[model samples]
Target chain A: MTTTTIHIPTLETERLILRAHTLADFDAIAGFYASDRSKFVGGPMSAELAWRNMSQEAGHWVLQGFGRWILEEKATGKTVGMVGLWYPAGFPERELGYDLYEGATGKGYATEAATAARAYAYDVLGWTTVISLIAKDNAASIAVATRMGAKADGTFPHERFGETIIMRHPSPEGLS
Target chain B: MSTLTVQQMLNSERLIMRAPQASDLQAYQAYCASPRSSFVGGPFDTAKAFEKFTAMAGHWIVRGFGRYVMLKDGIAIGHVGPLCMDESVAPEFTWTLWDGAYEGQGYATEAASTVWQHLTNDCQWKEMVIRIVPDNTKSCRIAERLGAILTDEAAPVWYPDSVTYRLYAGAA
Candidate 1:
């Protein structure tokens, strides 16, 4: 319910484990922003900026109690990337966020992780609604949202990414 | 110091090298709002500046090390210290002085020198490098003054032509 340094809730799906982000995940997070692939997120940045972003994800857990999570592949116990609830300052509303490393895509991992996260947000966090802000060019993410029962609901003029499609979770309670 | 955290301080003459604070948003926002901020991806409005400012303070929690808020006479003029991003091969020692009024006072060299020692001697880092856009001669001079020798590379996607200077831990 509230911030707890003692424990963090971890979620598991068929092939993935969604857990709180740790410094161990910093390199994956930072390297993502450092590469060209980070273009969809906010990337190709300097190390300090990448560190700043990695710190934000970790800080979000402490401050928001529930923030983006590290997506670990159960098959290898490797952190592929991050996904979960992201409601940072300046957000128009609470959002369902996700991102994956280069090698992790095209395997339905994003859909699987996002579905678990959406449920955690609705059932555990008790949020009435959750939205995923997909950049116009982020076709893969849009497809994942679609497969997870999200639909194009509106558009948000995001400060960084400009126009973004807001996809609403089909069921506010999350898929049972 | 080897045991340094974001909240720790490295005090020296004419400056206090401590971690960033929540209250730094104002001075940071003002600095980023000015045209002089172009070198650092600034000229941001209040909202953008707010995001950038908070991120500076928030970075400490995840990384365990970040820039300290540089203070003179108990006022925040800017930040300085060991900076390393996710993609960096090694950390960089820098004094990112903001506010045009605070320039040319030799604080960059002083703070950077102090930070370099702390990072090398106290922290025991093997080596560190500074990445600067080629046109920023003032910062380049500071790096040179700190005994950093120029070697190209380490530019981000935006600043493709940036100049990199490496400072070995053994340098005086």
Candidate 2:
């Protein structure tokens, strides 16, 4: 039996292990999508959609050479959220995105995970700059962007998501 | 168990069937945009089709075995083989040729037959099934030619309109 393999790099943070999404991660992802917390992240979907969504995330790594990572809390080895570089078909530019599962917010997990993702984008991927596209009313996510030194640059007219605010992260040179 | 690279999954006389790669997205998206996609529940918007394409490629990592894109003369014409969305459900044998220009030829059947043999003989899969919407007579015909038997078993709830055809390892 020959099996195909996709190489997704694993990164370590102070409190989280940013790693490839495993099949087991689907349970947590489906749960998140089923909840209201997924409201602004194209969620409130059925398990069927969630299954495809997880696969899309994994496939993104293969196709795009970069994609989201599962944010696992080191203390408990439990999944906290997913955060990484996102440049899907609809996006105007490559963006850094994060989604914290229900009960995982308010602990700075999103902020911590996103910071590492942005660093990977600039340092490893050789990206000069990246943006974070947040839903108009997602103040919590906006705050995370602010905490990471991203400034609201403009808004993008998303076909499905409507208008989303685009926060530009500090350029690699600007950071230094 | 041996390991094959992405481009070496399976092969037939006129087609090289391999794991879906980044390069296969364009043709796949074009198919999703075409009206001919109706039989497969498509004609999806760009975003939806992109997600579906990525998922198709990603399923290989998730299940360790997945559908392969059929390349004829270095161009992707279609995809075929096993797909299991849920662990509890039986893996399905599926086939889709992207363009109507390639239809009426035996491409889909040939690709499906090659994949079926690879999975059943080399991979040691004992049983698998094919689910097709009743309106997709072309695909149903391929299932028939592959020695699949129509079964009374209900299709997966996500695809309620489909009918099931079971294929045993030795039957083919």
Query: Each candidate's lDDT (Cα)?
Result: 0.76, 0.86
TM-scores, one per candidate: 0.66, 0.93
Query: DockQ score of candidate 2?
Result: 0.59
Q: What is the C-alpha lDDT profile of model 1 across B62-128, one tens digit per residue?
A: 5667777788887889888776554346776656777878889998788888877777766677678
Best by lDDT: 2
DockQ for each model = 0.19, 0.59
The DockQ-derived docking category for candidate 1 is incorrect
lDDT of 1 by residue, A120-152 (tens): 887788887888998888888899988888899
Where is model 1 more than 4 Å wrong at Cα? Answer: A1-15, A20-66, A87-91, A100-112, A115-129, A136-152, A157-163, A169-176, B1-8, B13-23, B45-64, B71-75, B85-90, B104-110, B131-166, B170-172
Q: What tens-digit string does per-residue lDDT give for candidate 2 at B18-73?
A: 88888888999899999978887778978778888888888877656778999888
Model 2 fnat value = 0.66
Model 2: per-residue Cα lDDT at residue A67: 96
Best by DockQ: 2
Candidate 1 clashes between residue pairs 3 or more apart in a chain or in different chains: A47-B85, A48-B85
